[model samples]
Target: RGFVVFHAKFAENYRLYSRSHFVKGIELMILLIVYEIFGQPYRSPVAYILITVSMWFMVGTWLFAPFLFNPSGFEWQKIVDDWTDWNKWISNRGGIGVPPEKSWESWWEEEQEHLRYSG
Candidate 1:
């Protein structure tokens, strides 16, 4: 039973991750096409703007892709707000974001809690 549950969860996560990467790859391709078209010397202002917006969209999608298919409802506004705050603070401080150790500890705790309740 435990193995079946783990396999199912793993499959779900793998599917989500694959889907996210596939979308990101498509975004990247679009960005590259836009760049190739408008990223040359003596480009018009409008072309530059288009390229910039395309790049931003690609990056935003890459950053937030994982949360798009989250089982817990998509909190787009909250995620954007949090990211904005973190970006502003990081720009001011010129420091790194969440430490890996701390992040790993929290993730471990969450996994253990989930298992405890799930089983």
Candidate 2:
């Protein structure tokens, strides 16, 4: 029998060459700024929810969607348009607050709830 089974270096090189990188760190930075302004949950619940939803969609569209699914003959109109539309930064300036109970149980429960509804 002929041997032709081992090609680890070539395979790794090819895989690394084909990694998806549609969205870069700069785009995420812009989105982070947007989130800081309109998405701060402590400032306004509605605005926070809106920003969260928008950022979620942006992440899905730019980060995971392009690589995972390739729609037939599909193209994008603009790069990271989902997060770039916000023109104002209110800068309400709020810091992260500790959750009630100061323990991991409540956090786990919240994560479980999110997973249950998210899926």
lDDT of each: 0.51, 0.41
- Point out where model 1 deviates above 4 Å: 1-15, 19-23, 26-38, 44-46, 51-55, 69-119
The CA lDDT at 40 in model 2 is 39
lDDT score at residue 37, model 2, on the 0-100 scale: 70
TM per candidate comes to 0.29, 0.28
Looking at model 2, the pairs that clash are none
Clash tally for model 1? 0
Over 1-119, each residue of candidate 1 has an lDDT whose tens digit, in order, gives 35331122222333345446655766676877677676776888777767577676766666555555444424566556545544443344211464322343333354456667774
Please report the TM-score between candidate 2 and the true structure: 0.28
